[model samples]
Target: GAGVSQSPSNKVTEKGKDVELRCDPISGHTALYWYRQSLGQGLEFLIYFQGNSAPDKSGLPSDRFSAERTGGSVSTLTIQRTQQEDSAVYLCASSFMPQGSGNTIYFGEGSWLTVV
Candidate 1:
């Protein structure tokens, strides 16, 4: 099947607006991850979902950031009362194997969000 896929490739909104980003991971991949990248900045881990549970949520930037996965296939990341600093490219990835294993993770073309 295909690799990870994210929706709303581009999003621009005024501050205080909320945004939801969706991700469709590869069929059977099981391990899903979210990352954020800002202009001229490196990717920062946001969250990781193993199966339907997120054991390492410490990566989330703030309380306004949240995510959930259903049926171990799809995930959504939501930012509430967005701020201009929240502007960045959101990326999703999936790996057939767990982290630290030899499996290669596949990344989707990031969804760009800009808060004005």
Candidate 2:
């Protein structure tokens, strides 16, 4: 059973550029979620997909941020036009159920994004 994983561990881009971050959830997990944590800030929910339900993207900061989950497993978060404010650690987590209560989410190390 592989744990959640994220690619590029770190990403550096300029303003107005586009960046794509990838996530691989644990095997057999039915729920996946994306979150962003800026330096010295709390985790902000981005999007989530569970089973066959429609994804919840309410937490996405802006229209520039979008994501998709393929085959109920892997997911990718794409920033259409990167900005300095978009720079943060992108974290992905998966759980056995759609939502975990009491802080049961297992998070990846996160993909650090830097916009210069």
Candidate 3:
């Protein structure tokens, strides 16, 4: 993909249902990230995967949220037992190595999840 691609641009799920969001990053990007933005709130880091190393899961909100990147390209974010408070726009981004100093990270349009 030329840019970060996210699926299910809009989703409305009932409370307690499970949902899965997918992202396909730009080719050759070594770093992938998942973030959540609640209404009027700043971006909240969720997970990050860099190269072949272990993923950084420190920012995930709770046990119900989990993510994984396969083959360093596509990634999936799963939410179990979704609650109304879990509603948010999930953004996926990817960047080349050396994220610092002039590196440009591309973000997807985002998957908007509305837990009803």
Q: Best candidate, lDDT-wise?
A: 1
Best to worst by lDDT, what's the order?
1, 3, 2
lDDT tens digits, residue span 12-64, model 1: 98999999999999999989999999999999999999999999999998999
Stretches of candidate 3 off by over 4 Å are: 52-54
Q: Residue pairs in steric clash, candidate 1? A: none
Task: Give the TM-score (vs. native) of candidate 2.
Answer: 0.92
User: In model 3, what lDDT does residue 67 have?
Assistant: 86
Local distance difference test, each candidate: 0.94, 0.88, 0.90
lDDT of 3 by residue, 1-116 (tens): 77899999999999999999999999999998899999999999888899644458899989999888889888999999999999999999999864675579899999999999
Show where candidate 1 strays beyond 4 Å. Answer: none
CA lDDT, candidate 1, residue 21 = 98
Question: Which pairs clash in the backbone of model 2?
Answer: none
TM-score of 1: 0.97
How far residue 55's Cα lies from its native spot in candidate 1, in Å, is 0.5
Task: Give the range where candidate 1 is weakest over 10 consecutive residues by summed lDDT.
Answer: 1-10
Q: How accurate is candidate 1 locally (lDDT)?
A: 0.94
**Candidate 1 backbone overlaps, count:** 0
Question: Which candidate number has the best TM-score?
Answer: 1
